[model samples]
Target: MPSTVFDIPTWVNPKVAPDRHVQIAKALYSVPGDLIGQRLSARVDAQTVKLYFRGELIKVHPRIAAGRRQTDPADLPSELTAYAMRDLNTLQRRAESHGTHIGIYTAAVLEHPLPWTKMRQVYRLLGLVRRHGADIVDDACRRSLDAEVVDVGVIDRMLARGATGQQLTLLPPPAPSRFVRSATDFAVRRPS
Candidate 1:
């Protein structure tokens, strides 16, 4: 009997449970994204594999050596990463294109030190434009800015309550101090 040779495919995208990420060998990889399932294809190279989504290359990883596990941070959405990796200027410009108040609020978000830290909030605000229309988001943003408070949570609540056009109340100014404390007040004194 003639011996038959079997060719084995080296690359694999093992199925994962719902709300879980795909596993490639010991490494976990992202399909289009973790939130939605999408068709993905992987091409094996001598030392790496390229992952594609909708014909667009999305991730690449080096072949896993025995007993080695590799994790690519880029595999996940930027928001899912440890810190939001985004361009503050770009996000601000996009918000500005919507409305002045939105622009101002966006500016505040970016101006805060380490803008990446606040990227999720900025992205949420941007997404609202598609959900509620620019007019409504702009109005909400305007109200938030005028209230002298910029917060996505507050804006989301207002939008949910159909208060986009409602006027926002300004916070009361800080109360006047009745007395000024001097540093000597805390000074230790020897017993008489």
Candidate 2:
């Protein structure tokens, strides 16, 4: 028999959300990235919440009121911290690091009443820079911006089709085909 019996605490089995957080008592707490999608054991007390994975303690967070979230930056991927935090300045600076046009394009796309709503587009544009290369994406952004078009899909299509401004600038028009007809061939004469 134990020297003293412990008080029964409230427990919940919560699956980790994609954002690397689990909810307890309507409040959210961060969890290690590796634990995402896995159900965790959470013990709720008066002042703190304790989380367990397979009976091993994994995280601890102070109890917050319902409708609030407590995030420890360490739990998020380094590259995603700015995104999760909705820090537009950080995102814009990252775009600027790629090129002047990319930064301008990012700013254009994010110029919304609710700027945070466009964060995914800016993030996807950054991925395009990684996939196609900064020079190519920068040129595409320049062309799109010049045309007053602020669509990321258009920029991605331009990159996919290799139709960047520099490439277009260096290429000349194709020569007319030998099978082309002369203007006289289609000329109509009055019946005489």
> Lowest-scoring 10 consecutive residues by lDDT in candidate 1?
12-21
Model 1: per-residue Cα lDDT over 28-71, one tens digit each: 54444563555466676456767766577777767665455455
After superposition, the stretches of candidate 2 with alpha carbons farther than 4 Å from their true spots are 1-8, 54-57, 163-192
Worst 10 residues of 2 by lDDT: 163-172
TM-score of each: 0.47, 0.69
Candidate 2: C-alpha lDDT: 0.91
lDDT tens digits, residue span 91-154, model 2: 9999999999999999999899999999989989999999999998999999999999999999
State, as a TM-score between 0 and 1, how close model 1 is to the true structure: 0.47
Backbone-clash count (model 2): 0
Best by lDDT: 2
Query: In model 1, where do residues sit more than 4 Å from their true spots?
Result: 1-22, 28-46, 50-89, 157-192
